[model samples]
Target: MGEVLYRQYRPQTFSEVINQDPIKRTLKNAVEAGNIAHAYLFTGPRGVGKTSLARILAKAANCLKLKGGEPCDACDNCVAIREGRFLDLIEIDAASNTGVDNIREIIEHVKFSPSSGKKKIIVIDEVHMLSKGAFNALLKTLEEPPAHAVFILATTELQKVPATIVSRTQRFDFRRLASSDIVPHLTAIAKKLKYRIADEALILVARASEGSLRDALSLLDQLASFTDGRATLEDAEDILGLPPFGMTQDFFDALITGGEAKSFAHVDSLIDRGFDMAQVISSLLQYLQMVASCKIQGAGQMESGLTPEDASRLREHASSATHEQLRRLLGRFIEAAEQMRYSKIPELPMQLAVMDFFAELQPQPSSTPSRAIPKADTRNIATTQNKRGRPAPQGALLDMREEIVGKWNELLEKMREYNHSLISSLRLASVIACDGETVTISFPYKFHKEAVEQRKNKLVVEAVMEEVYGRAFRLLCLVSAGGLDQKREATAEPRVVEVASSLGRADSLLDEAMKVFGKAEKPT
Candidate 1:
């Protein structure tokens, strides 16, 4: 049987390792100077070369013939270590053996000297899997081990490892390999294996790997076998289950062009093709991110893997969008991606996200004037309401309350266009009273009241109020256990009161006219 590509192409020396240049240089200099740390910790995401570097370090420490801090792979010691036959080099899978007893056995072995090499090397992969007692057992040995013993610990999650263990070791963090690095590496390997793979195919593999070199190689290995040592872009897409680049681009264009039907058509087409909804959202997000990057930093700053044509297309898309629009769309798709995980219907989240974004772009009614109240003023009104008492309604104020109560349903209907969730919370609330500046709403449920009282929700409610009533009014939410009727009766027909200075602001003549005659009709 053929050896797997990842195993066959593992880096045998520091120079061969991809990326993490700083860590490689430091470790190599230390090895050459014969100043190796007794305990070394390598932390990073999986498949990025943490274990490969650990093995190389072990071989370098005990290599009979070393050259420029790199182990001479031809030497017997290096060969034995590479072939997994070295007696002094020990590898422990901490995941499976995480008990104190398992750790005790390693401690027992540390007392002895190397059987074959100059230094005894212990490599514990996934070291964070060790239990508390196991870590405690290993802590002392890591802090002060035998002069001839060297401990190498590697973990993907550094937070799981105790601080005591981390402090005792020399920590080197590895980074995920970049697509630029992974591409050439894959190309080189493909050439060595005499495989015919397209450049686009390699790029797709590199991107799909998400910075894991081992994963990229494994994907290449799968592609080679599936396509009989020849792979193309379509093959990679099929194997990786990624949407076609053009389809992703079109979908994003639909979103940017505000073509709700076109966007939904793209999603439906993807669903019809049996594509994973999460992957579809992810691909859109990646394309959106690329467009955003191009918009902000130019196409030259885009990550590697784009064809010249792709880069040109991205630049064109970037021209059609503002940075803020791209940011908001990216946020919406990200939310869709997260919701897809829990959704029973896979495509629903993506569809909803699309609908929501387009809805935001929809033009408001002509009767509703542009927002005159600044966001800061709204925030101030909300703050003042929370810190002070609600003043009783006067004669005109009572008439205004009646008008608002009559149009309350109309307000909810307008609010539905902005936020359906806010409408849900607002439906539970009763308009108990309305002064000229503020509308007091009472909710039977505390949670419902709190939901409407949130800054964003309150803004939507107040904006909808302005749309329905032809004037701006702050919303004051209160939880009333005795219901709206009792709360209204308790304060009914109270004496006229002056508006608080903080809550009252002078209204423009136009606003006053609109409040009295409603918005004026445009001339025919």
Candidate 2:
């Protein structure tokens, strides 16, 4: 079988490593100055060339054809290392050799001088896999290794490596390659392999790899046998489990504008079609990134995967939402994608993300609503207030409260656009009075009062009132102290008593006092 593309094209020199210039420069300078550390640590995500570079570094230190700390692939040492036949270069898979005994063997080996190469280079892959005892066992030798020994450790999880192990070594962190960097490299390999795949297919492979070039090429290698090597973008998507480009836009459109039902329906459709939920969410995130970029930088500046029409539609959606809102959405999409990695039902994370976004976009009441008012006649409200001797409200305050009440139904309808639960609580209550900047709502029960008075629910209520009143107003929530001095509450009091009683009832009573302003009880 032919060599794998990644192995075939692995960097033999630091200059050949892609998108890790800082690491390359630092390592090359160290070698050139003969300032190489006793132990070196390489940390990064999988398949970004940490292991490949470790091998290169080993060859560079030992290669007789080294120029300015870079290895010449023509040299015997480089060739032997490239062909995996170098005697002095030792490779250990820590994952397989995780015991203290395995580490003790390394300690014993480091005590010897190089047999063939200039340095006895020890390369430990997935070093973080070493047991605590193993790490502890090597700490002394790693800190003070023989002059002829060079220990190089590589790990995907930097945090797992002991600090003592890490502190004793010079560390280089590898980065995940971007699509732009991976695509060209994959294209060159395809040409060498006689594969007739298009750039679009190559791009699909790159995106599918998610920054791992080895994974991308493996897919390309698989594609070589999966089809006739004349793979199209659709073929790549099928192999990669990505839905068509526009499907992501459709998902977002329904997700952002439509409520929970529409969003879930889209999720269900994707599931029915056998699309991977992780890939779907990832594609959605990519689409949103384009939208956000298009909003920040003009559409002309964006290279979206979406077609022109779809891109234009995205632009419209972008223009409609605040950039911060788009940012928040992107953050949620990323978080959901990460959470799905460890989930039992991966679809659940995406579902939770959808529900969260739905809640964020609008008002939805709590399932458990609080009681606000008793189901009874609202008729006695006004009459009972007059008998309580409450004075008639005058001028603008009365006008404002009355206007709020008159449009209460319309406002509640509008409230549905934000949170349905808001309307539910408001339905059980009414605006009894307003003192200019503060409008007090009287609920029939405490549960209804407490439910609506909740900070979030209260904000919705105030926002709705502001939309109706054309200004801001503080919300004051209360449960109606409906019953009054029974006989006195049924009879109109004298004007003198009205003045005194209005003062007392203003703070305590709801409808019975509100009726003193002669605002007849309307519908609840």
Candidate 3:
């Protein structure tokens, strides 16, 4: 029954257009100098005033009383163009009629003078949608249009348009409106409509619009109607399907401060409120990024568009954590975002991410002192596990695991000389236990396990071990359940004396080690 907000307030002059200063200036200069090109191309993101500017260009060039290369709103040419009743100003939806025949219709009329206005303006919106043949048909018309005819083309996707067409036309890129620009515009519209909408509501709408002023107005209009002109931030957020800011803050505090219960509680609230898990994770990532930026660049940046007090609260919350911690938390949140895409219960990914962050924060034991093995001897560290291989005592296996852990990297490198893919498979596998002539290693992924246990790969692994030990050892590969996180821990480090007593050849290894370390192996 009424005009939409975006259409109701479309800009009628170059000066009135929002946030496209360079484009406006260029077009205005051309008009003022009577240097208008036969064809003009406008390229930019959607909802950034491409189509609107094309219409304004038409009105400006054809206006009876053009001022400084801009159309006067009072002029007959400008008013009719604004009201969409100007006969000489033709707007074609190239998206619907994208064939050669459709383009020929325009070419057939090119020679005719303006029906009423000074210029015959043809505005082709989404010109990139025109068929290849249609573009070919239109190219000639654009290249050599009648003196009184002007062609204006607009496209959201600049690359799809043929370069030949682009080169012939004068080009202008429309820039997106910033939130700082969007917010005030919405506020002014709300005031004009006599809506009691809060500034918070306007900011939410502006952010949700993401630089699209048309979408921003549409959202504000929705909020105003839903609230009967008493719109609040909560109403705006609910209508826009945004996650609650308070919950995001709570979740951030819980995750960074080792409050696992509070973290899950916040997740529960978000799930109960029907907010998407992806949105929650996304908001958390943004929150951490802002806090990290504040820590590095000071609170002056306020990149998240939060209120000053909220920013201060964020800075205080982030003060307890180091930049390294914030970065790690951000990483976990990002990982959870990807996982959410494949997860059936989307909240499960976020929950798992929360658990992992807390687990990383858990205190770790001190590093156990290790004996330096000879570089040549380091390759003896057995690679991985297969349950079908030789078995041994728990004590013996634990002792061998200590040896394996000490030189795991060396073992992997030596195996790499035989088969790099074998070594790559082993990267996902870790020595968990051992036997007299066999070692047990667990692989996190089935593909790695399957790849390593392939008959040929298994032989290479065994050969590399034999080369290292001067004796044969069976290669065993086991698929570890639950992936890398579920891989078993290495055995506890035994005392040096105990290690020597158990290995027996630890005495020989120690003798070889003495030359390397240039020191005697102490009893401790």
User: How large is the C-alpha RMSD of every model relative to the true structure?
Assistant: 10.6, 12.4, 10.5
lDDT of 3 by residue, 36-66 (tens): 8899999988888888888888888888888
- Tell how far residue 510 is off in model 3, in angstroms: 21
What's the lDDT for residue 443 in model 3?
A: 51
> Stretches of candidate 2 above 4 Å error?
258-260, 304-310, 324-328, 331-335, 338-346, 363-524
Full-model lDDT for every candidate: 0.76, 0.73, 0.72
Top lDDT model: 1
Residue 100 of model 3 has an lDDT of 96
User: lDDT tens string, model 2, 360-397?
Assistant: 44322111122211212122221122324553344444
Clashes of each: 0, 14, 5
**Model 1 per-residue lDDT tens digits across residues 1-524:** 98999999999999999989999999889999999999999999989999999999988999888989999998999999999999898899999999999989988997899998989999999999999999999988987799999999999999999999999999998888888889999999999989999988998899889999989999999999899988889899999899999889888888888488988888888999999988888888878878887888777748466678877788899998987678768866776776676678888878867765664454422111122122223222222222256433244554666677678778877875787555544644555445567786655445566768889888888888888899988787654433224444334212101122224423432232223223332211
Q: Candidate 2's error at 377, in angstroms?
A: 22
Candidates by lDDT, descending order = 1, 2, 3
Candidate 1, which segments miss by more than 4 Å at Cα? 301-309, 363-524
